[model samples]
Target: MGRSKSPVRVITAVVAMAALVLAGCTKPGPSLRPTATTNPPGVFGPGADGLGDTYYPKAGNGGYDVANYDLDLKYDPPTDTLTGTATITATATADLSRFNLDFTGLKTEKVTVNDVDAAAEQSGAELVVTPATGIATGAQFVVKVTYGGVPKAFDEPGLGEIGFLHTDDGAVAIGEPEVASSWFPVNDHPRDKATYTVKIAAPEGLAALSNGAMKDKRSAGGWTTWTWSETKPMAPYLATVVIGKYRVKESTHDGKPMVIAVDTSLSAQVDAQMAQTPEVIDFLESKFGPYPFDALGGIVIDDRRVRFALENQSRPIYSSAFFEAGEDGTWVIVHELAHQWYGDSVAVNEWKEIWLNEGFASYAEWLWFEDKGEQTAQQTFDNSYAPADAEMWRVPPGDPGKSDLFHESVYTRGAMTLHALRVTVGDDAFFKILKAWAAEKAHSNATTPEFIALAERISGKQLDQLFDDWLYGEKRPPRPRR
Candidate 1:
C-alpha cells in the first residue's frame, strides 16, 4: 500500500567502520501577474494544498515553482525571538487564486503578494495566502511575509528535534526530514529548489552563520548582520542558520573557499578535526566530481543535546560533541561533507526517496576510509550483513515506511545496494556512474527510478532485477558475486 493511503502513525543508525556511527533539519510569492478583475477563465483556482508527497503528504505546495528566497531575519538572543521577512520570488505554473506556504509556530505579522497586501492565515503547518486579485499562469509573482516569535524546535516523532533550537548563547537550526518551516515559511519539500539569500542580524558579541559563502557583513547599533547567499538551487530542508559564540575560521583549499565555525567551548578539538575539511573536499571531488558548490565549509555548534550533524548545503552543521569524539567524529564529518554532493547537490524529489541522500552519504564513509587504506567498501558491506541486523531486511531501502524514514536500512542497506551495484557494473563504470550522477543532477531533485535508469544507461546493462532485489524486495538477496 502507498504511504498516502496508510494512516499516519505517531511512533517511533549505526554504521560499521568500527568507528563511524549514525546520527540524525518555505514559501512563496511572486513577481506575480497584476491582479485582474476581468476573466479569461480556463481553470483559475487555488494551488493544491499539498504537493502530494507519498510519505509527507503535506509537504511542498503545488501550482508554482519557487525561484528564489530572500530571508531577512533578526535574532535577539535575550528574548529568543526571531523577527524577519521572507521575500519569495516565484513563477506560477497555473492560474492561482491562492497558494499555501508551509510554516509552523511563528506569528505572521503581515503578508504581501506582488507588493500588495494579501490575506494570510495559519492552518496547521500550512500558511494559506489569498491574493486580493487572481494571478495568471506563466506570470512571475513576489511574496513578502513578515513574521516574528520565539522560534521553537519540533520533535519530529521518529526524526528527533529540529527547527530553531536554542543553544547556550543562541540557537542553531538542526533537525531534518522537514524543519525549515519552523524557522521560515517555505515550500518545505525537496521537490522545490530555489536560490537563497539569508541575512541574519544578531546581538553584538554573538556570531551568526548560515549556508553558502558569506557575501557581506555590516554592523550597526551594537548588532551585526551577516549575509550569505547560495547561487545554486537548494531545497528548503538543506537551508540553515546558526547563531552563537563561535571561533570562525576561513581558509582556501585548491582555490575553493573553506570556512569552519567552531563553538568557542570546543574550539581546541574542533579546530583540529576541521583542519581536515580541505582534504575531505579534495578526496570526494577526486571520486565524485568537482565539488558541486562554489564554496565548501561547515559550522560546529557547542551543544551535546544536538547529537547528530546536518548536511546543510555548502556548509554542514555539527554538534560540538561530534568533534570531541576523535576519529569517529571526523568520519561523521566526512559523512556529512560527502552529502554536499550526494544529498545537497543531487537531492531527492520526495522524502520517501531519502535513501538517495543517506545511502550515498553512508557509502561515502566507506569510500573515504577506502582511500585511507583503512578498509575496503567490500569489507564494510560484508560486515553490515550480520544476522543480528536481519530485521533491517524486513523493509527495503526503497520504502521503509513514513515513520522509518531514518531507519538503518536507508543507511546500511542503502550503501550495500550501491556496493552491490559496483560489483555488478565493475569499478570503472561504477565510479563513472557516481560522477555522472552528481554532475548531471547537480542542484536538482531526483528519484530512485531515475537513478536506476541512469545506472542502466551508463553501464549499458539491465539493472532492473538488481535494484529490485536489493532496493525494493523484502527479503535480502544473496551476496553479489565479485
Candidate 2:
C-alpha cells in the first residue's frame, strides 16, 4: 500500500556476495501428523486453538484444514445489517471433540454440524463449536453457521481499518492478515487456503461483486443475489465482497474472462484507467510468465474511506483516488495486478515472510518501468538507497514485526532486496527464478527460505550473505552493482 513518490536520483555504493545457508532463514514448524497413539481408544479430544504461526500464532485454528467455503450473505445498506450462512467443508487433521473458528462482532443465530444442532460459544474472537459426536482423524465434516447482525468495521491495531468497511452507498469487505473473521467465520490465515463459493444478496439496485467469475444473478422480493465461485485455492486474506451501485463491464482479455466495475460516482473518470488493465496484465504475463488466475479484471470502489488498494484474488480492489490521479495511477494498477501472480497465486506461509508478497509486487512495478524504457530498476533502487533516514533500514523486510506488517521498509527495501539478488545472480538466471518460483508454487503457500532455495537452485549460486545483508541486516547494505 506504500508508494514511492520522489523524483529519480542515482547513487552508488559497494555490495558483496555472501555464503548461502539453506537452514538459516525461518522455517515452518514441525507438521502435526495424526496418529492413533495420540488418541485414547478413539476418545477424541479438542482441536488446538491456534496454528502456531510465529507472527500471528492464533490467527488460524488447529486440528482441521478447510477445503471449501460456501458463503451465503444478505445485506441491507439502509439498515446496515448483515445476515450470513457459512457452510464450511473441512478435513480433520486429528480426532476432534470440538474445534475453533476465527470470528468477531456478529450475532450467531444457530450452529449445526452435519445437519445436527451443535453448541456454539463466543469467546473474544474465537468461535468454539462442539458437535454431538466426535470426529475421527482424517474424517471429513461439514459445519454450517447461521449468523446475522450489523457487521463491525473497526481498525485493526497495526494493520489499519480492514474487514467489512462501509461506504457512502454500500459496504466493501476487505480482509487481509486477520480481518476476514469480522465478516464470516474462517480459518483466517494465509496458510489454510481453500476454494470459495460466495453468494451475496443486496438491494435490487446495487451490484454485488466478489472474487473469481460471476456465475449468475437472480432477483426476488426486491432483493438481488449474485453468485461467484473461485475454483483455485486462495488464502483467506485475498477474499473480498463489494456491494454497491456501479458500472459493470464484462469482456475478454487474451482469451480470458475480464470483469471491471467502477462506482457510478466515478465511472466516467475511472473507465479510461480501467481500460488499460488488460495491457498491464499482458505486460506482467510477458515477464512473470502466464497469468496465474482463470480470470483477469479489477473493481474500482469510489470510497474515500479506504485509502489503499488490495490484491484480492482475481479482482484487485482499487480506490477511486487512483483514477483521479489519471496516468500516475497506472503503476498502482500494475502493482496490484502483479500481485495476482505473486501474492494471490503463490502466498506466504507465514506473515513474517510478507516480503514474498509485497517485495515481488513492488519489484514487479520496477520491472514495469524498466520494461517501458523509462529509468531502469537500478535507478529506482539507487534513488531509494540514497536516503539517509535510519528508519528506512531499521526493520528488515523479513522481520517487520506485527505492528509494522505493512511498513514502507517491507515494500521498498523488500523490492531493493530482490534487485540486489538480481545483481548477484545475472539477468537470465534471475528472471528464470521469478518464472520458475511462480510456476512451481502456484496455488500454494511459500516462505522466504523457500524462495532463497529456489533462487539458489535457478542461479546455481549461494546467496545467503546477500539475503542476510539486505533482508536481515539492521543497517542498509551496499547496493548491488550490476
Candidate 3:
C-alpha cells in the first residue's frame, strides 16, 4: 500500500512509510509462461489475453484457476455495514476438493458451490470450501459467496489490504491484495487477473461505482444496484470498488468520453483543476498510439491515496497531488498513461524488472518534453541525467541485495539507458525501434534483456554491452565533451 498516512495519522502509519520506501514485492505465477510459439529463446510475451496471468502452482491445494466473476457487493457507511455476493468461476489446476481465497474485512454469511449449498470454512478473511463431489483437475466450477463486514486491512494497508471502513465520508474499496476477497470473493493478486462483472447496491442518490464500464442500474429496496463489467481481464488489486456521495464531472477529450468523480466539495469544479488531461492524452496518442482503452478519465479521491496516481485501467485513480496548478505534472501524467501500454497492458513478468515499466514511462516523459520545444528531442537524449562516474551503474536502487522499484538510480540511470540506446542507434532508427517495440509486443511483459534483444535484432546491432553496462551492471558511460 505505497500510500502514506498523514502526519495527524503518523502513529497509525506504521507500515505505510516502510512500504513507500520499499515499493513492496509482487511476482507473477508460473502458469504465465508464454505459449510455446510466443516464447522465444531470448524473449516471452504477456498473458494470453493481455491482462497479466498469475499462477501459483504450490500456493494452495492443487492450485486454482480464476476465470471470471459476477460480483454483487454493497456497503452502508451509516453503520459501517458491509454486504455483498460474488459468483466466482474457477478451474482446479490439479485434483482437489478444497481451495482458499483471501477476504480480509469481509464476513461470509452464505456459500454455494455450483448452485448448491456446500460446507464451507472461514478462517480470518479466508473462505475454504469442500465440494460435495471431488473436483478434478482442469474442471471448472462456480462459487457463490454472500457476506459483509466492516472491511478490514492486512498487516499492510495499501499493498494487500481491502479498505472498507464506513466513515462520515462514505465507504471505499481500497483493494491491493490477492486480498480484496475479504470484501469480495477474489483470486486477489494481479497475475490471476480475470474479467470482472461487478454489481453494487447502495442507498439511492449515492453514486455506486466499480472498475470498468457501468452496464445497468436500478433501485432495489431503497438501495440502488450498480452493475459494472470489465470485459478486460484484471488482477484483483486493480479490480476496484468505490461508493460515496460523489460529484461527477463530465467532459470529452479528442472524441473519447471522460469523467472525473470527486467528493461533493469539488464536484462542481473538478474539471477546471483537471483540465490538462485531454491535451496530455492527445500528445501521447500522437506518439505512443491510442489511449489503450474505451475511454480515459481521472478519479481524484480524498487525500488518503497519498502521492502520484494509480493507473487503474480505463479510469486511473489520481490523487489531489496532481491537481495543483502548473506543477511538473507533464512528466508524471505521461508516465502513468504510458503505463497503459507498458505496466497495464504488457506487464512485467516479475517485480525485479520494474525498470521496464518505470524507465520506459520516464523516457516517454522526456520524449514529450522534447516534443514540447526541447530542440528535436535528441538534445534531451544528449542531456540524459546521470553521474559521470563509471561505477554509478553498479549501484542500482533498493538495498544492495533488496530491490526497490523507485530508487533514483533506477529512475535517472534507467531513463539515461534509453538515451544511451538512442545515441547508439541514431535518431531515425531509434524512433523506429521504439515504435516497433511497442507495436510488436503491444500487450505483454518485456524483460530488459529481452528489450535489448528486440532492438539489437531489429537494428542488426549488438546490444549485450548496452544492457550490461547501463541496466544490470551499473557503470555510467564516458562523459560527453563540453
The whole-model lDDT of each prediction reads: 0.79, 0.79, 0.57
Models sorted by lDDT, best on top: 2, 1, 3
Model 2 RMSD in angstroms: 5.5
**TM per candidate:** 0.91, 0.92, 0.77
Scored against the true structure, residue 477 in model 2 reaches a CA lDDT of 92
Candidate 3 achieves a global lDDT of 0.57
The alpha-carbon deviation from the true structure for residue 102 of candidate 1, after best TM-score superposition, in angstroms, is 0.7
The C-alpha stretches of model 2 lying farther than 4 A from their native spots are 1-43, 157-159, 325-327
Comparing 2 with 3 on TM-score, the higher-scoring candidate is: 2
- Model 2 has an lDDT value of 0.79
Candidate 3 off by > 4 Å: 1-62, 122-126, 154-168, 175-182, 250-257, 267-270, 325-330, 374-384, 387-403, 442-446, 474-482
Over the full model, what C-alpha lDDT does candidate 1 score relative to the true structure? 0.79
Which of the two candidates, 1 or 3, achieves a greater lDDT against the reference?
Answer: 1
- Worst lDDT 10-window in candidate 1: 3-12
